[model samples]
Target chain A: MTARPVLSAPPAIERHTISILVDNEPGVLARVIGLFSGRGYNIESLTVAEVDRDATLSRITIVTTGTPMIIEQIKAQLGRLVPVHRVHDLTMEGPFVERETALVKVAGTGEKRVEALRLADVFKARVVDATITSFVFEITGQGEELDRFIGLMAELGLVGVSRTGVVAMSRGPGGI
Target chain B: MSAATSETSLTGADIVLKALRDQGVEVIFGYPGGAVLPIYDALFQQNDIRHILVRHEQAALHAAEGYARSTGKVGVVLVTSGPGATNAVTGLADALMDSIPIVCLSGQVATHLIGNDAFQECDTTGITRPCTKHNYLVKDVNNLARTLHEAFYVAKNGRPGPVVIDIPKDVQFAEGTYRSPADSMPKSYRPQVKPDLNRVEEAIDLLAKAKRPIFYVGGGVINAGPVASQLLTQFVRMTGYPCTTTLMGLGAFPASDRQWLGMLGMHGTYEANLAMHGCDVMVCIGARFDDRVTGKVSEFSPNSVKIHVDIDPSSINKNVRVDVPIVGDAAHVLEDMIRIWKARGKQPDKAALAQWWEQIEFWRARDCLRYEKTSKVIKPQFALERLRAAISGRDDVFITTEVGQHQMWAAQFLPFDRPNHWMTSGGLGTMGYGLPAAIGAQVAHPDALCIDVAGEASILMNIQEMATALQYRLPVKVFILNNQYMGMVRQWQELLHGGRYSESYSEALPDFVKLADAFGGVGLRATEVGQVDDVINEMISIRRPVIVDMCVDPKENCFPMIPGGRAHNEMLLGPDEKVENATPEDGMVLV
Candidate 1:
C-alpha cells in the first residue's frame, strides 16, 4: 500500500506571555484554567497570586504557545471570562520582562563540588541550604538564563530541580 | 424596609424570597432535595413566585430557558446540591451558548462541611464557573441577598447568559439583610450598552455605498427585547435589502416578508446561503459569525465589506474580521444606524439591488425545500407544513424544537410572523431541549398555542418533562417526527462515513400514544400522509397536554446541506436534483 499524502500545517509556534487581572475569589483560578483546558488550549506555565489584597484582585501570569489565530482565540476567550477584568499579551505589547525562580540541588564532591560552587557564584545563585553530600542553590532570572544555569549544574552531578513558573509584566508605567 | 431593622431581622431564606419578589420573578422551575429544604420552606410561605416542580433538574433548567426565550425575561431555576446541580450543567451550558439570561439558585452543603465530602455536597461554583456568565458562593449570611441580586444583574445585562448562586444550607437558615435591586447595584460590573457614534457612522457609510447587500440577523435581537425586533424590522424594510436570519434569529424579522431569505447556514435554504456567499456588502446585526453559519471562514462572503453590530465586544472580530464593528445593544445600534442614514439623506441603490434580487430569485426558484410527496409515508417537511397550515392565522403561536433534522425542517417549513415566537437550542444543539421549553412557554403564555416540533430520538432526551406539563395542566402540543433514527447523524453517516450507521438508531422507542396516556395526557398518531393533517388538527384542538407522533419517511435526509467543512456555495442538494454551478474540484480539497 502506498503512503497517503500528508497535508503539512504551518510549523510557526510562537510563545505568548499573557497577564490577566481578575477577582481574587474562590474558584476564579479554576475558571480561568478550565477555559484553557476545556478548549484544549495548551498552557506552558501558569502562576497566580493575590495582587491587591484590599481590592480583592489577583494577577495570573500564563505562558502559552500556539499559532497566531489560536493565540487570538485564547485572549478573546479569556477576556470573556466574567471575573477576568483585563488580559494583556505582554509578548505582543512591545518590550516586557519575565522572570522565574528555580531551586537547584547538586550532589557532588572534589573538583565537581568546587566547579558547581564556582558556577553558582558566576550565575548569582545563593546557597540556601547545604548538606555533606548536596547543596541547594536558589537561582532567579529569566527562563533562558535559569535554563543555562541548570544545564551546567546537570554535568556537575545535578540531583533535583524545582522551579516557579514564569511571571511577567509589560515594560511600561501602566498596569493591566 | 428600613435597612438597619431588616439587616437584623430576616433569615437568609426569607431574604432570598423577598429579593426574588422585589425583582418581579413570577415563576421558578425547581426540584426540591435535602440541601434545599430551607429555601423550599421559604418558598412554601410565599405565593408571589409560583414554583413549577420539574421531574428532573435538567428539565427544570431547560424549562426556565424556554420561559426566558419566549418571554424575553431572565428565567429563574432552583435546585438542590450535588446531582441536582450536576444535572443542570447541560442546560446551563446551553443557555450560555445561546445568550439566554437565567439565574440558577443551587443549594450547597453547609459552609463548615463544604470540602469535607459531606452528603449531597459538590463544588457547585467550581463546576459551573466555566458555564456561567458569573457565579457566586454565599459563604456568609450577610452577602446572600446582595450576591443573589448581583447574580440577576450579571445574568440579564450585556451579552446575557446564565448565572449561578450556590447557597450553602446553613446560610439559607442564618439571618441576613434583605436587599432590593434598587439598593444593591453591582459596583464592579456595568456593561457598556451604547455604541460609539463614530463606528455607527462608519457602518452607515458602508451600507449606503453598497451595490449588493444582505442583512444577517441572529438571536441577540430577540434577547434585546421587542423594541430591538421592531427596529430591526423597520431598518430592513427601509433598506429594501434581502435579509437572512440564523436559526436563532428566525422570527426577528417576519418570515412572511418578501425581503426574507430563509434561515442561513448548514441546513439553511439554497437561496439564503447563495445570498450570503454572493453579497458585496453583508450587514450582520446581533449575530455572531458561528462556525455553522460561516462554513469555511476563508471563503465566507469573500467579496463583502462586512459590518457587525453586536452587544458583546468579544463577539465582534472573534470569528471573522469586519470593516465596521459597533459594540452596542441591537435596538440601540439599529436606532443609531437609522438616525445616521436619515441624516445623510442616502437611499439604497434601487437599480443595483434589483440585479442582486434577480440573482437571489434564480436560487430561490430551485425550491431547495421541495420533496416528493408519497401516499404511504409522511415526509417530515410535509408534516411541519401541515402543522403550519393547521395553525395558520394564529398569531399567538410559539414554536420550540429538539435538535436534528426535524429542527431544520421546522425552521424551513414553519412561518414565524413575530419576534419571540421561536425558541430552540441554536448554539449548543442540545437534543432534549424542546419538550421542557414548550412547557415553559405554555407556563408563560397560558392561552397561546405552544408546540414542540421534536424528533423521536431528541424528544426522548427530556421525555420526563411530559409529567411537568400534566402537573401544571399546560396545553403543550408535542409534534414528534418519528423517523426512528438520530436523523442528522444518520445523514452524515450516509454521506461522509461510508454509510456506517454506528449507534445512531433509536432502538426500542416508546409508544407515544400509550406514553401520553400513562402521563395523563392526550396522544395522537398518524402513519399515513392522509392522517397527518387530521392528527395535527386534533392535536391543536386539545386544551390539555397532547403528543402527536407522525411517523415520517425513515430514509429522508435534510438537504441543501453545506456538508460540514464545506464552503457555503458547495451545497449538497437532495436526491434527483441537478447540481447548479458546479465549481472545478481540486480533488485534494475534500469536505
Candidate 2:
C-alpha cells in the first residue's frame, strides 16, 4: 500500500487578539459570541467588561486563531454586529499589551512546598493563602507566564487552578 | 422622561401602531394570537396601516418579503409568540439571505413570566439571533417605540435585511410616552454607505484596461432601490460590455438588451456561464459570490481580475476573493464608477473586446436553453414560455416562484426587463414562498398582475395562502407547473443515488381546482400542450385570485445543470431529442 501524497498543506494558522467596543445593553455579549460560534470561527480566550459608564459601552477582548482570511472575516463580521461600535485586531495593529490572571493552589509540604514558594517568588507570584499542607498562589502576567507557573506548580502538587481569560489593549494612545 | 398624563401617554400597543404610522408603513402582513391581543385591539382602532392576515405565520413573513421586494419599501410582519415566532424563522432567514428589508414584530409572554416557561413563550431573541440581521427583546413599554423605529432603520439601511422585535405582552398593555423615529435614533448602528474613492478608481482602472470584461450583477442592486438598476443599465450601456445577472439579480438589467447574457450560475445559460468563466475582468456589483453562482468555488472566475461592490463590508471576500473590493450602496458605487470612468476617459481594448464578444456569440449559438418539445405532453419550459408570452412587455407584471425545477425554468424562459419585477426565495430556497409572495405583491400593486410560477409539490408546502389571497381580494395568479414528483430532488437522485427515487414522488395530491373553488377563487387546469396558452390568458384576464394547474412531463429534469461540486464548464445541457427517454446514466459520468 502507498501513502497518499498530500495534495496541499493548509495555510498557516495565526492567533489574533481582537477588541470590540459595543453597547453594554442586554444580549450584546451574546450577539458577539453568537457571531463567533455561528460562523464556526475559533475563539481561544474571551474577556468582557464595561469600559464606559456614561456611554454605556462595554469592551470585549477575544483571542481567536485562524488563517489571515478567516481573521479578516472575524473582524469584519464582528464589526457588522448592530451594537458593536469598533473592532481592533491587536495582533496586527502594531504593539499591544495583553495580560491574564491565574490562581494556583498547590497542596504539598516540606521540600516540595519550599520549592513551590521559591518558584512562585521567581515568577513574582504572591502567596495569597497558605495552609499547613497547601499554598494558594495569586499570579497576574502574560498568558505564557501564567501557563509556565501553572505547569511548574503541577510538579509541586497542583490541586486546583482558576484563570481569567486574557484581556488586551493597544500600547499606543488609541481607542477601540 | 417621567410618568405623564393619559393625554401624553399611550399604551405600548397603541405606540406600536403610532410608530408604524409614523414610519409611513402602508401595510402589514400579520397573524394575531393570544399574546398579541392587546396589539390586535389597537389594530382594530387604527385605519392607516392595512393588515393582511395570512393563514400561517410563515406565510405572513414571506408575504411581507414579497411586498418589500416589489415595492422597495420595508415589509412589516406581525406574529404572536412561540409557534408563530418559530414559523417565521424560515422567512427571516430567507429575507436575510436575499437582503430583503422586513421588520417582524413577534409577541412574547408577559414580562415576569418570560423564563417561567409560560404559555406560548419561546426564547424569541435567542432563537432568532443567528437568523436575523439584528433583533431586540423589548422589555419595557418606554423603549417600545424607539425599538420599533430602530428596527425599521436597521431593516432598511445598507444591505437591507430582516429584523425582529420580540415584545412582551405586558409591555403592550403598559402605558408609555410615544416617541417618533427622529427622537429615538439608533445609538450605535451605522453602516458604511459610500465607497472609498481609491477603491472606486482601482475598479475603474481594471474596467478600463479589460479585454474580456463582464458585469455580474445580483439582488443588491434591486435592494438599493430602482436607481441602482438604472445606473447599472446606464453603466453597461456606456461601456457596451456584456452583462449577466444572477438568479436574484434578474430584472436589474434589461433581458432583451443586446449585451445581456441571461442569468449566470449552475442552471444559468451556457453563454452567461462561459462568459463568466472566460472573462478577463469581472465587475461584480452588489452580488456576493454565492455557492450556487460560483460552482466549484476554487475554479470560479479563475483568470478574471474581479471587482466586487457590496454595501456590506463583510460580504466582500466572504466567498470569492476580489482584486478590488468596493464597500458602498450599489447606486452610490455605480454612480461613482460612472463619474470616474467619464473623467478618466479610458476605453476598453476594442480589438480584444471584439474577440470576446465573438466568443460569447459562438457560445450563445449553442442555445443551451432549447429543449425537446413534444406535442403529446407539455414540457415545463414550454408552459413557462407560453406564460411568459402572456406577461411579457407589460411593466406591471410581477413574478414570484417556489423553489424547484420550475423556478429555474421560469428564470430561463421568462425575461425580466425591470428590477423588483422578479421575486423568488433565492438565498434560503424556501418552498411554498410563491403563493403568499404573490399575494403580497398584488397587495402592493393592486392593479398589477402578480403571478407565482410554482411546482406541484413545492406549492403544497404553503398552499393555505390561497385563502389569504381571497380574503385580501388580491388577484394574484398561481401558475403551477404540475409535475407529479419533487422534480429537482428526483433529478438529483437519478444522478447521485443510482436512480433510487426514494420518496420524491408526491402521492395523494389534492384536486387543486376543487381546492381553489372551495376557497372562492378560480382554478384552471391544462393537461394538454394545446390548452397551455389559452389557460394562461384566461388566468391573467381574471380579476380574482387564480391557480392554473399546467400538468407537465413528470420525468423531465432541469438542464444546463452544473451538478453539485462540479465546475461551471461541466454543466449538463439536457438531451436534445427526448428528455423523458434519457436517463441519468445515459452518456454521462456520475461525477
Candidate whose TM-score is highest: 2
Using alpha carbons, what is the TM-score of model 2? 0.97
CAPRI rating of model 1: acceptable
TM-score of every candidate: 0.94, 0.97
User: What is the C-alpha lDDT profile of model 1 across B70-120, one tens digit per residue?
Assistant: 998899999999999999999999999999999999999999999999998
Docking level of model 2: medium
Per prediction, the TM-score for chain B is 0.97, 0.96
DockQ of every candidate structure: 0.42, 0.79
Report how far residue B444 has shifted in candidate 2, in Å. 0.4
lDDT of 2 at B290: 91
Residue-by-residue lDDT tens digits, candidate 2, B527-560: 9999998999899899999988899999898888
Q: Counting only residues 3 or more apart in sequence or on different chains, how many pairs clash (N, Cα, C under 3 Å) in candidate 2?
A: 0
